[model samples]
Target: MRTVRYEVLPAKGTEDKVIAHVPRDVVVTVTASPVKGLEPTLDLATRLAAHGYRVVPHVPARLLRDDVHLKDVVDRLRGAGVADVFVPAGDADPPAGAYGGALPVLRRLSELGSPFDHVGITGYPESHPLIHDDLTVQAMWDKRAHATYIVSNMCFDPRLLGDWVGRIRRRDVTLPVHVGVAGPVQRAKLLSMAAKIGVGESARFLTTHTSWFLRFAAPGGYSPERLLTRSAEALTAPSSGVAGLHLFTFNQIAETERWRCALLDRMTG
Candidate 1:
């Protein structure tokens, strides 16, 4: 079960592109942004669901207004037949309401009888620029009870990712991990799209996951195949608890899906 993430931007034909390219039943997780608000995410999820995709819209804590708003959002998603959701602490400086981070929102969701079948929380393999490693690990431990799975943020180094997964298991967090990797994309186009959507936050993410970008930008440099080959052992190991791939398509749906299919064919050929 592969998952793909997409930013909720105002680009035309984004949903159409996704429908045309993305295979049905693959979970498409729409990203929530402080700049774009949550409407687009929710709307896109609904549209995708109607098109027979298992859509998961990110419910960022900072964007939510309150418990009431959370309930309303849950109701809407339920009505749309969405069974999965991912929660992240958004980049918003001042949160929209009581929820300051994903923990509180997740706790609230639990209190609401856990509306969704699968609740996902973010994990970091490398050190976060703003947060300490210890706190990030502890946060995962604390949220383990509420979340059904973990979706790791984009990480370039396979060794670092394997070590991070081992550390999480040692800390007693057993959530299945969906390793994040960038789908096949040109570095220039990815950066261009990110800049158009939200320069500040997107740039920060690129900085964090820049290794692959730098290599990809260089002539005939590193590719997703190399990353997968390097990481395959740890990801497939039983002890590692890796569940699946979470490709950061960056809205390059057509190209990403094509790459995915080609990779699958080659692997099974």
Candidate 2:
């Protein structure tokens, strides 16, 4: 079965609204960046767990200052019965603490002997604004042993993603991948989510890459209609090594869910 994962971008009470719409069988991952402070991380994870979703909250490296902080995070997640976590370097400007990158955090997590059944890291199909392409791939390799899977950043081009996945597997990094793509979102709504979530870095990243914006604005901003066919073709190939799909819904939970259901029906029919 194809796996569908929903990203929960922390918004004020948006969690309640969003989670209400998601089916229990769908995997929900809470984004750590939006929660801002430390407390929200555990709070949101707990809330999601209470609501019956298998939550995978992000654990950003920059957010933790020391071993103590790391332990607290792990303890909290374990307490909430969370078995999966997505670790990213985060967009926090000027490191919040000693951890400069995800690799350091990955090593530390392994040292802590976390009980999580799965650990996820990020992959960029398009280049990240601050990090180099080579560095990003190396980071994946460096963290591969500790990570059970990879969740890619948003990408509009299916070709780029297919090629990127091919290249990653060729390099011998065989971690299962959750290909990330934005859900059926309106342009204005996407930007609003971007602005509200403080995704200035991502907005800048998108703007700098004119092709990305141009493609999104071309006709249908980002409908999964064609995207899924192309993505599925790529993922179904044995060499692709992709495990699932991660949708950045931009909080268009209702529409995204509708689209996913329709797609699932089509596939079943």
Candidate 3:
């Protein structure tokens, strides 16, 4: 079975909807917000775990206060039986404390005995709006030793995504990649959610990657099938090491889940 996962933001008071709609045992990655801080993420992860889902909370390095705070977070997740975590160098405009990026937090996790079974780091197929492409690639190489896998950031062009995956493999970072795709989302809602979560770069991302936004702007909007089929050859090849699909739901859980189920039925039928 190909691994399937979902990414969700820690929107205030959305826990009930998530618990009621998301299937049991699904890997739900809770995202961190610069405005909201990490408590909501931790709280959602705990609640999701109690409801029998395998939860992976985003531990944004910039938000963490110190080593003591990191320890506390690990302990909390451990106590909740959450054994997966995704670390991202967050968008917080001046990091709160000692840790500046995901690499430092990843090292600290190792020093603290690595509580989680699967530790994921972010990948960018599309160039990050602020960070240079070379730096992003080098960052992956630097963090590979500490990470178990890579979860790519959202990208629209499958050919570009495929090329990026191949480039990573050639560079010798062989961690399995969970290719990221936006689920069935409306453009206005996506923008609203992005703004609400304080992901200002998302606006810049949309502007810089106008082609992607245009696809979504069309009638019936963007379809994951387009990306899936286009990328299949590369993703399924022996050398590609593509693990599965990671849907960026953007809080549209019901629509995302429906799309996933329909696609699964088609694949099986």
Candidate lDDT (C-alpha), each: 0.80, 0.79, 0.84
- Candidate order (TM-score): 3, 2, 1
* lDDT tens per residue, model 2, 23-108: 88888877766347556766887888888888888888777777788888898889888999988887666767888778888888
Q: State the number of backbone clashes in model 1.
A: 0
Q: How much is the lDDT of residue 259 in candidate 3?
A: 81
Go through the candidates in order and give the C-alpha RMSD of each one to the true structure: 2.4, 1.9, 1.8
lDDT of 1 by residue, 1-269 (tens): 24444433434687988878877757788887787788888998888899998888988899998989999999999999999999988777798888888999999999999899999988988677688899989999999999999988877678988899999999999999988876677877766766556432334666565675576568767467788899889888999998888887777887788887788888788
Q: Candidates 1 and 3: which is better by lDDT?
A: 3
Score every model by TM-score.
Answer: 0.92, 0.93, 0.94
Clashing pairs in 2: none
What value of lDDT does candidate 2 attain over all alpha carbons? Answer: 0.79
Ranking by lDDT: 3, 1, 2
Decoy 3 TM-score against native: 0.94
